[model samples]
Target: MNPKNPYKIALVLLSLFLFGCKDSASIPSEEDLNAREQTPQEESNQRTTGPIDYGYGPGLLPLGDEKISNEPKIGFIYSCDTQLNGGGAFKAGEWINESEGYWDPNKKIMVDGDISWANAQFTLETKGTTREIKGNGLPINHNTGTYPISTQDEAYLYDRNPNSIKEQKVVLSLPVQPTLAATPRCASGMVAIALNGIAIFNGLDAGGKDAVAHEIQDQCDGHPQKDGQYHYHNLSNCLEDTPRDTEHSALVGYALDGFGLYGKKGENGKILTNADLDECHGHTHEIKWEGSLKNMYHYHATEEYPYTIGCFKGNINSENLSQPENNEKPSMGPPPTQP
Candidate 1:
């Protein structure tokens, strides 16, 4: 009756087969893409060998991504936001939940620019032309206990820090390899930056008091100032670092002169003291830096005063280092010209 309709039947079967195979060749699924095409160092644990979050927020940056090219070789990856939780609210909006703000020594709370301005944020960048190590000076972390001077009285050596934590774009053209300065000298403030993006001031409080001794610090060993900029005046455990066992010292941060700063311990399970270091609280050795393979000159934090760095071991970046003491309040410039 239907004669030889076998040819039509065969064509329909072929079409079905092609349709079934079409989905197989379709664009790869997300799972497949993730398996096949993630960054080389994308799968590392931050605590072990990558960028770490100092309780700021969540993001990923591979510290050992060899494909990343640069001039100022970064020892570690940094968050674009400097790991700051931002000026306002704990998570979102403009400080709706003020309860989450850090507690002052008096158990009071401080908010961004509320009593004063907010903290600044830093994002590291490479100046393509000059090979300068560029960073946005951010006031991300600070202890509210002894800060804001709160009183607009010149008697306390301040009315208020005229400067808020505005992003101060700081740059330093460092030597690829650091060398000894002819005569090392101590500066007014900010000899370095901790890995968490906080500035490291010298071990001095207002009125030239020993910061680590007399100044009120938070549980993390830091405090803020009139500018609302949070910083460390001594060796603070707030820096994110792998806990050294009984015998291994860990690198904490870098000095402005291009050397590394280490913790208060040595490799031999010995508590390093100021005696172990030079005038700058540093010594030359075969340090196991994240990127360096050879021995180099680096500073170490002692249990005593000037816990981090004492002075400049290498040529200091004059543009980056300032006479913070001279201004003691760099923010205190002339008042606005009122109409």
Candidate 2:
């Protein structure tokens, strides 16, 4: 109250300074604010170390009476005019974000309290002319989005995935040198196994719709089925290391017919479009095969519909293909409603 009272003024100023400091402490720092904005799945993805185990017990189910031959006849050849609900095909400009209202790469639900596989395993062995691929069906190299979309996650509003990822007994006896079949066959069921030890399914969803365009997937572009088998409907960019501008995309997986599946880039580092590939979503060209550059038939992933394989270009052993048990059948009646 007294302007000339220096001691009182000093006391008041010190109190104000201490109050300001307390208020500032209550206000979060920039780094703390940034961390608060990130979701649990986002935080899990930042990990650079090996897979994390969040105490989800180790229990794997057996592949039951599901047979590849039992799957309904829903296979088809790829075409540019392939009609997809929500949108015809994925273009480079379109991306998964909050505004899209369908899919978001940044937003992911958790699966069994895990964002990545905790017990990943895979191995490829060659003996004489046959190559044996074995694994517990889990992604060995990268991470996955959560499953059974948590009610709190924004992604849950779009896709309420009710399945949790689980390990499976997977064994495939493929050929070291696969030969083209006399006639291309429609691919169905578990069509391929990625290098990371995950399954690669065909493009169709349970309703015969374009799975890539309709269904919501994790940041790694994967989701689990009812059987808890985590698989990919399209190419996940995390599958391979970034290819140099001069390098061709690396082999990411192997189709049921023993043909190699490559990434987006083709010859001369060109991002391939539908026009660049055949009806089977593949082309014959010289590529590094078994340590030597040789001309071979192989499939390629694109941004469009039928993103991976369109049809089987090589001989496939149905016995070697492990089908999903109690696989959801495509609706024979009217088209089901979309989310």
Candidate 3:
């Protein structure tokens, strides 16, 4: 059951009536069915929005039955202060020319036709010298002998030096103080606008699903779980936007059916790293993936490079939550062309 349609009020009413008339063995009359059917508006109120868990939103929202906050932390760290064209544009990271083996920001578009680009623009407004950090930490996977690498160019010991891979720590740390610029600096590959870290996208058809996997896995090398949804980090290279400047980044929204950032194991447990991006709550929306590494609030996107996905430092103030600076124009970069 899609948790959104949780328990029905009608069922509750039926139980109450049955208990009240314990001796009555006869089936409910038409009146009971009519009364039950009249609660559609009540059900609508309860079922309109999917389950939201507080864990996913850092205690800001409810995490439902799934622990969506326990996945590996992967993102980028950016400083607001580096803009091009007089804070009018953000620096853009060069797209990779290839599509095999390693992950890169060059291929963040869906190949299929269902999920197209939505002209939603995002900007970074600062109150003071604010610093934004985004990163994902993956647990040590001993079975695959896989580890994390901060950059795409970093050579994994397994591919180059097998013996060295074993000696090295199972976890690889990639740290950077991203410069905030109007250029597309931080974002690369597909980026989902997750609140605190919970994905909030809609549904997708089969082709759209393939397109999402191809874009995410192909560009970021995220491993596909048994359900075929890809989950992995891509290259997030970004520059910072300074006090008087801003930055931008591109994003792709994938339309998936019952898709989320993670799924569930049993009824009450979270499916950490499952084949389903189920933690995103199957709300039949679009998952917006970033094309750059810059941090911005989960809701904004930009065609400019070096994006500030959410709030930026150096500009923080009392209006931190209410007001943000997004001075860039809404323009879309071309979808993945080739390589």
Per TM-score, the best of the predicted structures is: 2
Worst 10 residues of 2 by lDDT: 1-10
Q: What is the C-alpha lDDT of each candidate?
A: 0.42, 0.56, 0.20
- The TM-score that candidate 1 achieves is 0.52
In the range 1-339, model 3's lDDT, one tens digit per residue, is: 011211122333333222111122233332442233212112222211113232322112111111112222112212122221211101111222222212122223211111111221121122233322121212111011122211131221111111111111111111112222232222112233221111212111111111111222111122222222223221111101111111111122111110112111211222212122122211122222221222222222211111112122112122212211212221123222334
lDDT per residue, candidate 2, 196-269, as tens digits?
67898877765445565546566566777777888887776445422254456767788988988887777776
Which regions of candidate 3 fall more than 4 Å away from where they truly are? 1-145, 149-299, 308-339
Colliding residue pairs in candidate 2: 109-146, 110-146, 110-147, 111-146, 111-147
TM-score, ranked from best to worst? 2, 1, 3
lDDT of 1 by residue, 1-339 (tens): 011000011221122111111122122122331222111111111112112232322221111111111111112111111122111111111211223321111221222121222443333332442224444444333222334433332212212333243344455555546667786654445777764356777665443433444343433455555454566776654343223345435555568887777766665545665567776677776655423355778887764555666667687667666513211343343333445
- Candidate 1, which segments miss by more than 4 Å at Cα? 1-120, 125-136, 139-167, 323-339
Please give the TM-score that candidate 2 achieves against the real structure: 0.65
The local lDDT score (0 to 100) that residue 159 gets in candidate 2 is 51
* Every model's TM-score: 0.52, 0.65, 0.18
